[model samples]
Target chain A: MSRIEVGQRILQEDLEWAKANSLLFHKHRVGCVNMISSPGAGKTTILTETINALSHDMRIGVIEGDVETDLDASRIRRTGVPAVQINTKGGCHLSAAQVNGALGQLPLERLDLIFIENVGNLVCPSIFDLGEHAKAVVLSTPEGDDKSAKYPAIFARSAAMLINKADLLACGALDFDVEKAIGQARRLNANLEVFVISAKTGQGLDQWCQWLRRLVSQVKILGQA
Target chain B: MHEAAIAEALLKTILDVAGGQRGRPLAARISCGQFAAVNPEALCFAFDALAKGTRCEGMRLQVEIRPVEARCSACGRIWTIDDGYSRCPNCSSQQFSLLPEPPLLLESVDFEDKTDE
Candidate 1:
């Protein structure tokens, strides 16, 4: 009996597919951002607001992933940007293979930016790289500031974080400590950029859209990378 | 669960390695991060069931879950952490780099070699 040490990545195929997606994005000069959050964290609302704020100014595409419903994708389509709906059936996270298929369905060359709204999940989605240039996580104030401490994996990997639903805190309906959430997330990733936003009140949407434009320009207009 | 999906990938990897060999696979060793949230039981169950009609039927599995380790970027002290707590024990600094950890890795495989070596 011989013991062969075959050190391999168990999800090599999925990761390879993700890599291919990056190449596709690079060739098309598309700025793909993967958005992650828990359920009811205002991902769809923020997307609609952001798209409404920037669709006329920049070319954007959307890929919505959910366990069962296409409602989010439908909502994104109302913003007049092309959005694809991927129903995972029961999968907790969107896989690289699934994203690859979605990428094929989009108008890659015609768009300068793409947003993938991942299934509302904190854990599984953070682990999978969908070949996006950046990962943006949405954390609503009602979810509590300690969420970053609990789901550090996601916080650590995210490039930018949106503290959504800040209007709740303004009205004294919730007591989410924005500084505490930012501190916890920054502990994991020192360079994390944060935005306190409220999709309902139109607070902080300008800065969020501004960041999105800068990222889009970095990849499309300048980097071509 | 993604366990079934991950199991299929693991089985495919082991089979690819065992391909064209004179003997069948006997055991495999893998490692996962402590915070990867993968349930070993579900993975093993899926692997065993998928291996039922193959040469890898009843294969033994050795799974090692490694804790999260980090290095203080300031004081150059390395420490192991249980989870998301990233503060360095020595320097009490949050400015540190986490050790690179792949979520899942198949380290080694054991197989019977029927052919003359």
Candidate 2:
């Protein structure tokens, strides 16, 4: 009745660390978003766009994770927001403990939204919860429509899907069908909200921004009540 | 790639749970839920490498695989699935609350203390 275990104890320990970080996030009233996707999927671009759009209206902070560079965090800081970069050295994903350490350097009390840009790997980040309210998977148009079926684990655990680089869809280089891709994603997470946005062209980003606004407002209302 | 980090995390948890036992531990048993996409071979390799020169060295690592299962909260239907299927089978409802099928649990540990007996 028992099967061979694969990373059970390790994952459990990570889960405990994740829970501890979650408690800190809740206490600070920070709505954390763990942004995950394949490398070159424009995770940082989306983050920059998000920060630019909301920085005027709300206080925002970012935790940029990468294998060995402060490049992403440096870019985020250019947007005039407090951003911290976590160099995993060789880690494929960002754990809650790492986030916990980086959080100490940032002003969590001043931020309404905290975006944790996970190391660019769909497979690894999905396994470790970074104490986020929800995790988002960003797939560029060129990644193809089949991503949902191919990497269901990330798609399944994602609370929402951001179809980036919509402008590239016209070039026929990307076999992406926004509607069908959304349909398949819904099969895994029925409540998943799909957004087609071009962080470069500024297309379909308003909807995403609006959704974020709603989430922030809801958090505010809940806190007040 | 993160398997090494995971292994390190596991060792810390084991030591904490063991409560500073007076002797070396023999082995540890763990259960991984089906939803957790962990390659057993990679994990074993990582664990072996991480355990080197540590107190947990030469200990047998046992991993148990737990398949993903879902029971609908509204319809009360239970179904076992491969990987990404999260909906209910009978009522086709998405309202089911997930049971913690994936244990990711450190079930038990074996410690050796020839001197303490």
Q: What residue pairs are clashing in model 1?
A: none
List DockQ, one per candidate, in order: 0.63, 0.31
RMSD of 2: 3.8
The prediction achieving the highest DockQ against the true structure is 1
Which residue runs of candidate 1 sit more than 4 Å off their true CA positions?
A173-175, A221-225, B113-117
What interface RMSD do all candidates show, one decimal each?
2.0, 6.8
- For A133-164, candidate 2 gives per-residue lDDT tens digits of 88989999888887887787787788789999
How many Å off is the CA of A190 in candidate 1?
1.2
Q: Which candidate should be chosen as best, given lDDT against the real structure?
A: 1
What TM-score do all the candidates reach, one by one? 0.92, 0.87
Model 1 chain A: worst 10 consecutive residues (lDDT sum): A216-225
